[model samples]
Target: MATETASREPRTKTRTTASPTVGAAVVKRTRTVAVRLTDAEEAAWIAAALVDGHRQLGAWVRERAVAGYLGKVRPKAGGGGLSPEDAAEVAALRQEMTKWGNNLNQVAKAINSGQVPPVMAEHLEKGWLNRCGQALARMADRLDALDDQG
Candidate 1:
């Protein structure tokens, strides 16, 4: 005898395939983090991000912060980049200082060895002591300026 089969309703079965179409790591790689925002300023911040195409906001803020910090710093004696003459003067001063340092070291060794005549030793000591005094005076002047600032 032939049996009559009922019409099957539309099946809602989900695919349970063993292999996924995409890798798990790639699927979950990018995550959006939510941050609390002030109602008033949120629009402005988002507008900035949109205007800049969401690129380099951190760098822009960092540059602005650095500029503000530099603005607060005290200006050097001549300020900004040095002029050619100023650089040349600094180079000359460095050479002079190096020569003085070598002279001072040799004199120190001579004095320490106790072989040089006492007269020569006294004169060298006197000259070096004067230079040291001048250097200390300049340091004191710088410190005084700091004190004045405070």
Candidate 2:
């Protein structure tokens, strides 16, 4: 006597392999998620990444996603990769330098056009030039300090 056989489908298993560690933590990125974004959505993501001081869009996206999932708040990104306090100080120095440069230019123009005496122009140029140089020095120092800390 012969018996009847039942038909069965083959089953395949999905793999979740661990990837290499990124940064200071040993993160095993075992799964991949695919997302489809419209042009406007991609542009918005890029802008947000730039605003967050992130050079890598993927990293920024992952960070935002994880933060959102975990309900965490991150810092702002308005200082060209600098802290808020450092950025503010740098901005103030930049404004001061700009003002000094303008003053020096005006002094030079006055001297050239014979609107001011030679002695007065000399004094004004020297003062403004000194202020500009000081501001530049401060900016450099601040950047150097930031680099050191970073």
How many residue pairs clash in model 2?
0
* Top of the candidates by lDDT: 2
Model 1 segments more than 4 A misplaced = 1-80, 125-127, 132-150
Q: In candidate 2, which residue ranges exceed 4 Å CA deviation?
A: 1-80, 117-122, 125-128, 147-150
In the range 82-123, model 2's lDDT, one tens digit per residue, is: 554554454455456577778777877887887997776667
lDDT of 1 at 21: 47
For candidate 1, the TM-score is 0.33
TM-score of each: 0.33, 0.37
Error of 2 at 12 (Å): 63
Scored by Cα lDDT, where does model 2 land? 0.62
- The candidate maximizing TM-score is 2
Model 1: clashing residue pairs? none
